[model samples]
Target: MHGTIERLDDSALASARDRAWSIPLDEFDPGDPELFRTDSFWPYFDRLRKEAPVHYCRDSVFGPYWSVTRYNDIMDIETNHAVFSSAASLGGITIRDTPPDFRRESFIAMDQPRHSAQRKTVAPMFTPTHLDQLAINIRKRSAECLDNLPKGEVFDWVDKVSIELTTQMLAVLFDFPWEDRRKLTRWSDIATTLPGPDGLVATEDARQAELMECAAYFKRLWDERINEAPKSDLLSMMAHAEATRDMDPRNFLGNLVLLIVGGNDTTRNTLSGSIYALSRHPDQCRKLLENPGLIDSFVPEVIRWQTPLAHMRRTALEDIEFRGRQIRKGDKVVMWYVSGNRDDEVIDHPYDFIIDRARPRTHLSFGFGIHRCVGIRLAELQLKIIWEEILKRFDNIEVAGEPKRVYSSFVKGYETLPVRIAG
Candidate 1:
């Protein structure tokens, strides 16, 4: 029975892929985990944009969904919040279907009134004045990290730099204990992990246990903050905010997970991706080395090129006709930002990682509409400062081995990227 079940599962997956391939490009399913893991999703997306800007996958590991592949179509869908909902109850913003019993509600997963209220509470953190204050510390940290790198010794850039720097930034944002900062990365990984050897949890049961521990730790912080005076840190801000203060235990844990993952993955992945991209395109790196003034333009281009979060899911709130496609109420609709960034109609030389593009911020990596990445400025700032520090310290940061990519369709990121610096 066990062997039969295993073979049946394999056959079903093979059948699914075969069907996906055999169908018209417009009907192709882009949700396969293997495509993203192998970094071969570009051609599939290229075909989707050229053939079917608005596509649909009748079935996937997640479920039936519509994919808006073109740049304009994605912006249209993202901006039309009235037609499409991001409510947690409907299925929060990822292709992964939120289980009925395991509902985790956060501001990013909410729509309209509540999302506005909750988001307003945290918006101040990214303000120009606030970010300016944060910049000093970010540069200091970036310099220290780069200075400490082992010269000429190959190391996992993902661990040594990407994870370390982002994790440190997260710890400061939450005013979390510096010693326990790495826990933030672990929880972030667990929250987004798929069930497998690469996943943090082996089963749903294990995931729940780890998440509970995450909640318990944060609950203690919540307890401490609630009793104290309102402060500038995220924990205090959320604890005092009218919209989020009275949140249920699950919602509190949900929002905490949301913030951690938001703050961790996007920036970390881009930092790793930037190095890998630059290594592959030496001319671009050389151009940047010649002109450090291009860091502002270079950072956004990397965000576009890397597209850390590949897709964002939305549930249709009402029946609507989008580009001749019939989308019914409660149906899943995904905005494939990864595909849109590469849309040649919008971006010139979309495949190449050019640092000095005339319009660098035109991409949808940070997304469109009110639900755009709240920490986008901070993400950009960190990347810019880190690269500035990197160039000051090293002549060339060479890729030492093939990168080990994360096994997920959602978080387009690296697990390990080996590197050695030349001065």
Candidate 2:
């Protein structure tokens, strides 16, 4: 029965590999967005990890970049920020290069003193004390969403549960208007989407227009909050904070994109992934059902199992030789977190969703170094609460159909996941 399920689960992947081998081994382009959309990029990374851990692609749609496939190699690059810069001036943090005119600066894409100063502005919001206070509300909302799931009826979990929960939390954090909260989701999509026929935007021009609208709307909020006294919400925090208070239009917009995407995508996709993965591994799901105490371990394992963001790009600051490969200055280096999480050398049974792994937290999903996800605690809290509430409410969330994955290589998220609960 397990073998049957496994074969059925990997049918799409089996077909994708057939086409994936058409490209020459040396010229393999792992950044092809279509490979991700079809859920067929696994084999490509597997080959890279074995053949060329520090492989370079001379050409891709996003131009030239190096793929760091192994676990240690990625950490080596991620930790040395002095050598691998995340600045927007040096092409930002995605395989896609930032256009000269459209270049925007956010702390995630900045280095040193400026990055430290800007990061400090929002650091207090994710502290243990603040998260503890937020936990009460998180549990309340999670319960409400899970309890309200329609019994014996199919629904898109990505929209109703995953997107709904993450959207609500973001709204509360930013004190954004409740009715207009979905705009956050739209802007998050726009900010990350590759402009193309197959992707989010039809043209670069339309992408910029939507971004301008996002900037103008936030500018209004900034204008209002700058006059008022300090408050705890993210908008007010930025408005009153010294470093972010006087941000230019582009800088303000860039930070908003970072916050929205960070706050929404990672936790949201993982929520959907938990249900999907559990459905695939009935043994683990049964174990979880029998022992609700496993929620603590289960959450982090799911984050690693579903590596929400596949990779983050960093530009080499100077000419250097890494792993005997000549890496020149101004070169783009991408850390494949998805591949690293599945590296068998570092993780035991790395591909399996082991809910009770001994060291569940040992993965590259949150990344390494100073630029590690600022909202890691908040994300874990949201996932833990949702699953805790889920166990109290339902025995199973059946995967009604194959999930539709997002087309972009950067976001590495679900477009929809159909699920149904028992009556």
Candidate 3:
């Protein structure tokens, strides 16, 4: 039965790719308000899934490429990491143009034995067993953040709570001075902001400048810690690993920047979007409020509705036939998780945000295979706790003004969510 299902999926994707795809190659405007209506991208993805799951277009500003959107089709490419790889030294994990400084930097851009080695050093700490130790603290912090929210007043949820809370946790992880944690957050914002969308903004320079400054600051902190022993934070762990077992400083910076995103933006977006989702769906909100036990399921549903990291790009390491479309060895292929998470075949209903939805956690906002997000559990825990606390503290919470979305196709999330909360 499973084998037949798999074959049918493959055949459907192949047929789709052979058909003329609907996505225009001309300059893509992600900012179009029409896009916001389809931001979850259901209609377009459904069309693309039927028309061309791995179809190509010639006019994309980052140059021509195929969009790999269906769940199984994306799974085939992502799971076969050796063929469609992130280790491409040129463009790195993304197909967009790479910064000159990053052409040969970071473990994320490294392949094979080296990638395994660097990934191993930090992977142990992120395991569920280790994360279990930190859950209590995360819950405590989340409660404190929510418990202190200004009652009956409107505030930007993204700025006032989500970003602030996540950055504080990141500071705890990095063992940095919590007071200046916003610097790390700013560097991450800039890092991911670069090669902006279609690689059009020329903001990569500014992003690199901020990253270098942050890296230098980290190096200085490492020196200071060496002069006077520091605590057991992620930075200290990386520093020790670097000194005892060879590790590149640039890789540390790259991963540190990556960690910030893993730890901050996704969680922030989830929290911010959770508030918006709750405000919009009063029934689900009431359900969560009435039966907080469902908060666990609600976390995953929020991710499904507000998928934090919308998409991740990969470059073909070798000529490959993805759903019948020939992806040349140097070709760029994007995995639209934004589309895949909403894939009708993989998900039931695909549109409803049921708080008690059976297994709402099945979606993959986190990448699959070798590069799957290590902090997935932590992010989930943070969201669940925040929801629990909000439900307890505020009887009613709502959007008081227009919500603004972050202007990035890759990390499509909320930038401002105004709300009035009452006890």
Which number leads on lDDT? Answer: 2
Off by over 4 Å in 3: 1-42, 194-202, 226-231, 242-245
RMSD to the native, candidate 2?
A: 2.0
- The TM-scores, one per candidate, come to 0.93, 0.96, 0.86
Cα lDDT tens digits for candidate 3, 1-423: 000011124565455434324446243322232343324344556667766666675665456667777878777777877887676464766536565566534555566667666666666567777687777778888888877788777788788888888988888787788789999778767766634454324566766777788888888887776566644566666666643234566666767777777888888888887777776667777787778899888888988788887677777888877666678887877777877887888888776778888778778788777677877887887777677677677766767765666656667667677777764
Local distance difference test values of all predictions, in order: 0.87, 0.88, 0.69
lDDT order of candidates, top first: 2, 1, 3
Better candidate number, 2 or 3, judged by TM-score: 2
Q: Which candidate model has the greater lDDT, 1 or 2?
A: 2
**What is every candidate's alpha-carbon RMSD to the true fold?**
6.5, 2.0, 7.4
Best by TM-score: 2
Which tens-of-lDDT digit does each residue in 366-414 have in candidate 2?
8888889999999999999888888887776788787899997888889
Ranking by TM-score: 2, 1, 3
Error of 1 at 331 (Å): 1.1
What number of backbone clashes does candidate 1 have, counting pairs of residues 3 or more apart or in separate chains?
0
| True-structure Cα RMSD, model 3 | 7.4
Superior candidate under TM-score, 1 versus 2: 2
Error of 3 at 352 (Å): 1.1
Q: lDDT score, residue 382, model 3?
A: 73
lDDT tens per residue, model 1, 373-407 = 89999999999999989888776777877688888
